[model samples]
Target chain A: MSETTIGGIAGRMPKFIRRADPAVVTAFACIVLLLFLGSLYSRSFLSPEYLLQQLKVASFLGVIATGMMLVILLGQIDLSVPWSVAVGAMMAAAAAAYGPVGAALAIPFGICCGIMIGIVNGIGVAYLRIPSMIVTLATNAVAQGLMVVYTGGFSPQDSATGAMRYLATGFAIPGVPNAVIIWAVIGAAMVFVLTRTGFGRSVYGIGNRERAAYLSGIDTRRVVMIAFAVSGGLSAFGGVLLAGYASKAAQSMGDAYLLPSIAAVVLGGTSILGGRGSYLGTVAGVILITLLQSILSVMQMPEAGRQIIYGVVIVAMLLLYGRAPASR
Target chain B: MKDWRYWLAEQRGTLLALAIFIVMFAIYTANHPAGFTANVVQTASNKGVLLAFVAMAQTLVVITAGIDLSVGMIFTLTNCLASWLVIGTGLETAFGVVAVLGTGLLCGAINGAIVIYGRLQPIVATIATGAVYFGIALLLRPFPGGSVNEDLADALTGRLFGVVPASLVALFAVVLIVWVPFSRSVLGRAAYAAGSSETAAYMSGVPIRRGKFAAYALAGLLAAIGGLFLTFFTYTGDAAYASGNAYTLFSIAAVVLGGVSLFGGKGSAIGAIFGALAFRTIGDLLFVFDFDPLWQPLFQGVILLIAVSLGAFALFRVRNRLEWFL
Candidate 1:
């Protein structure tokens, strides 16, 4: 059962449910089921406009999950995504308050802050040898503290740049959203990096067996560090897009995305243990989560019930294909 | 190894945790406006023991090389539950407390079964279960306005015999009744073996699953005990999501400070209690020193970074790069 999923070469998964990444097939099936269930509540659920809106919303989570997938691919995790997202948006908005050059720098400056945080996370995990969970946790706290200090007990006054707003909401295509384009671009990059590049192989290698990877002459620590850095940058970008979507930055804005992104990635069928997963599955998972969330809201489900369903879904998915083998 | 060496090694983490708590507490008291008064001690104990209990719960799961992110959620869930049920007559209050503890047990058992029997990794599994627990908590007290039996609350939270803190007494008794028994039992040893080397433990005929299941279940019970105390202290329940997450994070910090290995099989709950108390004082230190309370997060983060880094010094000593995998 376990051996089939490992040594996953791209295109190796046949389209059939029996041989395909079981989690991916399950996720798509769940997506269809959710759409059917949603249509039962409102015909708007299957309407093109509503579906596009869902994709736009799913884009934010999708970007964040992109980072999560990379880290999870290396069999590590970055718990700092929440605060990284916050810092990125806040800093971008903060930077935009300066002038034209500052406005131009705003996006990079925001992303840079996330990269800086990622580098710190990388150092802790790669060099310091601290567990990724704890180190990212500490960095998250630090980023949070920095934001609080910058804001000084109030919501950020700086607003998203006009460009930021346009990128998030404007129709870059006649009917498609700019945010969806951005997500597709990034998703394609991730697919390429994971499927064709040496870096991707190193990630799978390290996740599967760190010692073996190290002995094989791979710079394991550097790969681990870069994976975390990439995760950090994407999380920050997710925040940036979110700020643009809302047109302003606020305290705790990133909080809502944290659990959902994680839930989305795992739902997409990536193993929590790291070495096995597909980008297509993550895309499917993000849509599934977005639809599930939107439908639940449409049904007027309370926050408590939503949380329970989210938890149950993640647990169920993990049970479906992410279980640890007894040997470990 | 010599007899004393083994004994010393076993007690080292506990002793260090105790010593750190003592030093931090002494400084806190020395600098306080109230000095070393009974009231000061009482307030500190009341606040510290809440975390102390949660940390003990985390310690149980961590010892088995598993983590329960749901501990803080369980603490909050039971607190909300206790606020609703733990009121009115003495008999009714007893039943309420029992019901609250039982819910925690059930929540924990579900986590254990999911992770152990279903073979899911503990981290993601607990994260899911935690959401469920927190959701239940939110449903129970959507507006956070339930009350507890004041008499029971006061007796437990207030000073005992007008000198010592009642909470500290309860904490000690909990150690004796819960921790000591579990630590001495055969199951506990099996847990250690399983954590340190599951393959070896399995080969040696250890009851790995049973031991882990007990650890996870007991962790839930301990967290519920923490929840019960939280209700006693505030006399109400509020399902504040941020506070629940903070407690979960801080418990990990305490476990590290207590010398409990996140890697598992290396420390005691007694150490974790002291570690929790010490971590609480780290926050309280800002109040005494008159630092801007705003600096607390940054200050705490830096200290946590330092504390976890201490564990990394061992990495520097590894002669072979392969040893770094550990």
Candidate 2:
């Protein structure tokens, strides 16, 4: 409430605020550039309908990236995301295959599976002293293997329930997709949690230096576990939305979203090293990736070209701002 | 306290990997319908050596405390290139092999340049390059219908001396030619020093950059060898994205199982090769046991989880909370 409390480190605060500005700004600029590029290929690229379609797609990544941002905030990563997304969707759909009760709890059931995965990942990374990348990578494999066994090496037969469909595709505030609303709500919550909550500050602290945070009595492991859990939950939630949009869960549905989410996060100026990033930048990043993808597809780029461009974009953005301060 | 104790401690990981491989092979052979036959062993070795090479590549990068997510992509790319180039008469096939390996070297050098000079994180940098390599692979083999020279493929994939699988022999030869010399070299020591503590290595004026660059480039070269072998086995090159991703993940798993610390500055390619063999045997065990083929993935996953969990036991010995970071 007091200006001194906030502005006491007046010199430091501006740099902190400004540090978040350029990445988001650059992302927005890229979005505009992409829009111009897209329109050159198609006249309707700038249409409200077309843009809304792109927004709906980006919401899926936005939701997933929200969780990614959290773990990344702690300077950790969740490589389990791809299969976690599939597990969430398939389990939710499988649950809905039961009766009314199952249908009603399908979404929650799916998210719970993701949370369980996160807890395991957190245990491995936070308690076991395993690196997060390896831990998450192993968990991803485990999740995939489990999913395969559950599906009998075949695609799941269940379809997304009506509620799932409505939540993902139906218009909530007329003309606005429900998925966009969902992403916005999730984004708002993410921003509030990051800027206004102690847990958020602790995440930044631990990412910056875990020992310092632990010594400060912040219960760093609990924070890390919670972050990974949230990431899992969010990824599964994204999968659920994806299943709804597609009307069913398919094997490996989450594979395509993994790199784009990471690219979006890093493009938004969040340090892959963790400890430094903002939610707004991630939002901008999600949109940028979505547009880039849409435009690439609209241009009828082959799979090879798409992959090349995608890689080039990520490396270029990373090279631009993601460099370490030359610790050597 | 004794010389033997020091040797034992130093070779602990490699020995463990060897133990694991022997045990798994025993189980596999015991359950196998044909028993412990040369054919089965040869088949297993052929399959295992592909992963062994990739694991060796991963070991090199990880030793420098970096990771090359692109290794699998390089493997795929080189496989595809070999499919196109490693064909025709003996002279042409030789040229193609050289070309495929060269492309792999170039790819690894690019990765090293970006990571070292560009000052980017190895993980993210490799992920980006991996995408590019896979794209190139896709472009080369849009369809899985390129040919490799049959003579070379047969000679490489088949048994030698009436019993020894050539693939396994090649793997052993590579260890002698590549890993042995590298391990004894100044650059390799620098890599270890860098991985253990980059700041300390830097302060000590270690050639961290060159060491790391060599590691990355060599990793690429090893993955390329794996690619060439893949072409030999499959007789074609298919840039299956899923397969590429799987190899990348499995190489990490193999590296860990080999007792190579993912944290870096520890372990050996010999351990990783044994780890790969053990991992491959885990899959084959299911076949021998007459389990449904679908159960293979689950079995592999569980084994990997258990193998990785073995490393966690060390954490319990940390007396000081601060030492957890170390």
Off by over 4 Å in 1: A1-19
Worst 10 residues of 2 chain A by lDDT: A1-10
lDDT of 2 by residue, A80-153 (tens): 89998999999999999999999999999999999999999999888887889888988898899899989998
Q: Each model's TM-score, in the order given?
A: 0.97, 0.97
Q: What is the C-alpha RMSD of each candidate to the true structure, in Å?
A: 2.2, 2.1
| DockQ each | 0.76, 0.75
In candidate 2, list every pair of residues with a backbone clash. Answer: none
The 10-residue segment with the lowest total lDDT in model 1 chain B: B298-307
Error of 2 at A99 (Å): 2.0
Q: In candidate 1, what are the lDDT values of residues B177-261, reduced to their tens digit?
A: 9899998898898888878888899988999999999999999999999999999989889999988988998899899999898
